[model samples]
Target: MDGQLLTYLFVGISFALYIGIAIWSRAGSTKEFYVAGGGVGPIANGMATAADWMSAASFISMAGIISFMGYDGSVFLMGWTGGYVLLALLLAPYLRKFGKFTVPDFIGDRYYSNTARSVAVFCALIISFTYVAGQMRGVGVVFSRFLEVEIDTGVYIGMIIVLFYAVLGGMKGITYTQVAQYCVLIFAFMVPAIFISIQMTGNPIPMFGMGDTMASNPEVNLLDRLDGLNAELGFDKYTEGSKSMIDVIAITLALMVGTAGLPHVIVRFFTVKRVKDARKSAGYALLFIAILYVTAPAVAVFSRVNLIETVSETDYKEMPAWFTNWEDLGLIGWTDKNADGKIQYLGDGPAMEGDGNKPAFDGVSKGVNGERVIVNPSNSVNELYVDQDIMVMANPEIADLPNWVIALVAAGCLAAALSTAAGLLLVISSSVSHDLIKKMIKPDISEKGELIAARLAAVGAVVIAGYFGINPPGFVAAVVALAFGLAAASFFPAIVLGIFHKRMNKEGAIAGMVVGMGLMLFYMLKFKFHLFGGGTSEDWWFGVSPEGFGAVAMFFNFLVSLVISRFTPAPPLEVQEIVENIRIPSGAGEATH
Candidate 1:
């Protein structure tokens, strides 16, 4: 069968499975809606948690970034995965012991202040909404390709699909749906990698294949060959890095702390039965996530090698069908600067336009005035206009894998996109309904009233998310990275201090959150969005990129909170007792409704 038919078959079946799971696990009460009634098994919850965490960034774009960034790309691998250790060891058990429906719930009750709770609610909304937009953006891209629809229409369809189960089942429905999604997505991610690995290095496992000798040419190491090829094409060495060390360390640290603080991730622990189960759930999540994380580097290696070998200096008229298909979709584009029919991947380099009549991929031209479409190559070497997001999805096609494998990748990308989108929507809905309405606006609202409100909030959040997807603020990778920075700045410090600092008053907590999160947002808006005229790297506080600035903001949060808490009055006696209880293991009982 052709690729589109196979895509329909695989993607259709995956959607069917999710819908079935949602129906079977429809939530009946507010507790069920919010935390799956705190009864989900550790193993099952772990699968859902993995699905929740391994989003479009992880499944679709990460390897692609790694493919081009080379050693500099390891920052994402370390940053995103490292925070799980912090989550498992530091925050998960304590938050699970607190037994709340949302992160704001813990902040409200633990800090014993409606104002702090309100701030937490606002921050959660910002972080979750920003994160969800990236996922929806991914959904739009995949839907546009697989379903043959415009990007906006695809985003609208994605919104409706998420609205169905997320509103119907809440966390209960989302959790089970995510478990099934995890299976489909994981299978989708690995199959192509395994196939390509064996084809290249005679190994079924991608990680091992990354280091093994090439089957096609055993005389040279696969990585060595890639490095030589990269240099020959005027790119940096494949195994070496190009970023400053401080930026790498800073970006990785920010992502790690940001991961630890993400509200959607923290909320998953609330669905389990016991504190121990929460810890185990986190451990299991790390294990499942590791499966993809380890293989991702391998995928990056293969894709980089294959892309360079296939596309560089190849004649435009002889390009593969996938190339033209993507080009027509406006994703890939080219203009021969030297008027040569062959692509020049390194058009922007020092040797271009005059040296040896240096050829160049002069980027996408509008075809206006008979010019070509505009293009953005990964590096100065402009042979490819392939966006970083297309790395993994285009992997099988690049390697000439069968149609079925390409279709399976489509299913996996959807699973990855939809799973995280559902999880983020659940958090958004709960924050508005449970945190804002039920807790703050109508403290006496009935459980039934709260549940209804939650569903309404889910609908509203979907609309907002869809809008942002259609009109994105940044690329998938950049937006997702900013979300991490927001989480790291706003939530991580407050939660960690709330658990450990008995003397931490509401005044201190609120100030820290305001300042820390405020600084991070200011930096992103000024830099990423070009608000307030424009931002320059020269204006960065200490040469930190917007992506790495979150770690700096987090430190400021800790510093501001600790300094202010020293002068402020201590928390109330009851709040102190609550904090103490969360730190222990034995007295933890069922979370109250």
Candidate 2:
């Protein structure tokens, strides 16, 4: 079968499996909808957690960004992986012991205030929506290429698919569905890495293959060759770091704390039966997540090497079919600067005209050299524009990998995108139905009414998510990192203080979250989106980039909370005791209230 047909087959089968699991495990009660009745086995929940954690950002964009940013990309790997460990070791068990349906549920009861719950719900909504937008964008990118649909149309399809499984099955359906998605995504991610690894380095294991000598030239190792290629093209060495040390540390710390504070990943532990089981699942999830995280650097090296070897100075008319195929999608472009028919991929010159690096094509028209006619063609010597987002998806085609391998990648990308989308959608819906409505607005609402409300909230969330997907703020990983930064600033301090500090009161928590979240938002909008009287890197406070500002904001949150709490009355005796009990290791399973 051809690649397109195979892509359809693989994607179709995976979608069917996800929808089937949703039908099989559809939640029948508010308990099931919220926490899958809190009875999931550790192993199953671990796989589900892994699937939920590894979104499109991990599977599609992480390596893509690494391929371009080189050593600077290590921050993402370190921050995200370290953050998971922080979540697992420092947060999961206590939260599970507390036995709330959501993060807002825990905050509301633990702090003994509906206002605290409302603040948490607001934070959760912001974090989840920002994060889900990346997943939806990933979906659109994959569908636009494999299924040959417009990117917007692809997002529409994704919204429909996510809406069905998420609204129908809720947490119960999402859990089992994620288990399957984990398997598919991991297999899909590793297969291409292995194939390209052996083809390029004569080693089957990608991690080791990345360090092995190139098959064509035994004298040079892969990384050395990659560094040489990068130098030849006026780019930074792949092995060296370009970002400042402070920015690197800030980004890494922000991502780490952000992962711990993420409401969606935190909620996964609540699905399991016991506090011990939550700890067990976190271990299992770490193991599962490691498979992809470890392979990502190798994949980045392989894809980056293959891209430079294949595209640089290549003739536009004689370009391979994959080049034209991607060019047709307007993701890959070439301009005939100096009237040369050959392509130029030098790093010194801008490949695009405006601030945007992406090409704005001229409606299927072709240049004289058979390159896609881009309206925003630059005057720079470089004539190529390849979006970094395409590196992972286009890697298989660039390496001339087999049809089955390519098809499997398409399926894996979908699995990664949809699994996390479902998880975030659940977080958004649960916040509205359980936290805002049932817990606050109508404490006496029926279970059925809450379920309906959750579904309706999901529908609204999906529509909003689709809009952002169609108009993404940045590339997948960049947007996701910012979301992590938001979580770090807003939720991390509150959750940590709520669990560890007996004197932490609602007034302090609320004030801290508001100020920290507000600060992070202001920085993000001004630096990232250029909204709040936008400023350049020179204007950044303390030399911190927007992506790393979360750490600074988080510090302010801790500071504000500490200062405010010192002046405010301490928590009630019952709330203090609840905090005391949450930290105790004995009878943790029975501590679920």
Candidate 3:
């Protein structure tokens, strides 16, 4: 079968599987909806948690980021992996023992204030929406290129699919569906990497292939050859770092703490029957997650090397169908600079003009060489423009992999994106229905009524998520990273203090969250969106990028919480005892009181 037919087959089969699971596991009550009745086995929960954690960012964008940024992208690998360890070791077991349906639920009872819960709910909404936008954008990218639909239409399709499963089955449906998604996505990610590795280096393992010499020329080392090609193109070395040490440290720290604070991932632990299961699931999740994390760098190297070797200085008319297919989607483009018939994929300068480095196509006009014409072509000698997000998706095609492999990858990307989208939408829904409405607005709401409210809220969240996907703030990884910053600045400090500091009071937690969230938002808008008359790198505080500013905001959160807690009345004796009990290693089943 051709790539398109196979793509439909794979994606159709995966979607059918997901919908079937949703139908089979539909929630009947609030307990099933909120926590899957809290009886999930560790292995199944671990697979689900891994799927929930690895979003579009992992399957689609992280490798792509590494392909372009090279060594600078290691921050993503380190920060995210380190953050998961932080969550597993420090947060998951304790949160499970606390027996809350959501993060806001924990904050409310732990701090003895509805006000604290309200603040947490707001933070969760902001972070979840930002993160879901990235997932939806990933969905659109996949559909637009493979399914041959417009990007907006693709997002609409994704919203419908996610809404169906998320609303109908709730956590019960999403959990089991995610387990399947994990298998699909991991297989999808690994198959192409293994194929490319074997093709290039005669090695079956991608990790080994990354270090192996090229099969075509045994004397040339792979990384060394890549570095030579990069040097020839006036780009940074393939294995060298470009970002400053301080900025790297800050970003890594922010992502680590942010992982601990993420509401969606935190709620995963609550889906298990006991605290021990939560810990066990966390360990299992790390093992599952490592399968992808370890292979991403290798995929990056393979994709980048293949892209440059195939396209650079090649005649435009000789380019393959995959190039034009992506060109039609406005993801890959070329201009006839110097009126040469060959593509000049050289230079470190902007490939296209205007904001976001995106190409502004000049109608349907084609250059003398039959390449697309961009209206605002940059002065750079380079004559090619390729979006970073396309690297992983286009890798299989660039390397001339089989049609089935290409199609399988499309299905995998969808799986990775939809799993996380469902998880985030559930967070948004539960925050509204369970946290805001039931806990705060109407404490006496019936379980059936809350379920209805949760489903309705998920529908609304889907609409909003679709809008943001169509008009994304940036690409997938960048947007997701900023969401981590938001989580770190707002929720991390409050949760840590609430658990570890017995004297931490409601006033302090609430104040810390408000201030930290406000600071992070201001920094993100000012630098990322130019909302506050955005300035350049010279204007950054402490020379840290907005992506790393979360650490600074988090510091202030901790300071404010500690200072205010010292000045305020202590928490009631029971709350302090509860904090002490949460740290105990055993007897978690009875700690819920």
- Encode model 3's per-residue lDDT on 254-287: one tens digit a residue: 8899888999999999888888899999999999
Report lDDT per candidate. 0.85, 0.91, 0.91
Residue 404 error, candidate 3, Å:
0.3
Every model's TM-score: 0.95, 0.98, 0.98
The order by descending TM-score is 3, 2, 1
Give the clash total for candidate 1. Answer: 12
TM-score of 2: 0.98
Tell how far residue 221 is off in model 3, in angstroms.
1.0
Ranking by lDDT: 3, 2, 1
lDDT of 3: 0.91
lDDT of 2 by residue, 1-593 (tens): 89899999999999999999999999998888888888899999999999999999999999988998899999999999999999999999988888886888998898899999998999999999999989998999899999999999999999989998999999999999999999999999999999999999999999999999999999999999999999999888999998899999999999999999999999999898788899999999999999999999999999999888888888877788889888887778787876778888887764441223566788768788878877877666778787777888999999999999999999999999999999999999999998999989998999899999999999999999999989887788988999999999999999999999999999899999999999999999998888979998889999999889999999999999999999999999999999999899954553232
lDDT (tens digit, per residue) of candidate 1 on 424-454: 9989999999999988899899989999999
Pick the winner on lDDT between candidates 2 and 3. 3
Clashing pairs in 2: none
Q: Any runs in candidate 1 off by more than 4 Å, and if so which?
A: 347-372, 375-383
Please list the residue runs of candidate 3 whose C-alpha ends up more than 4 Å from where it truly belongs after superposition: 350-355, 590-593
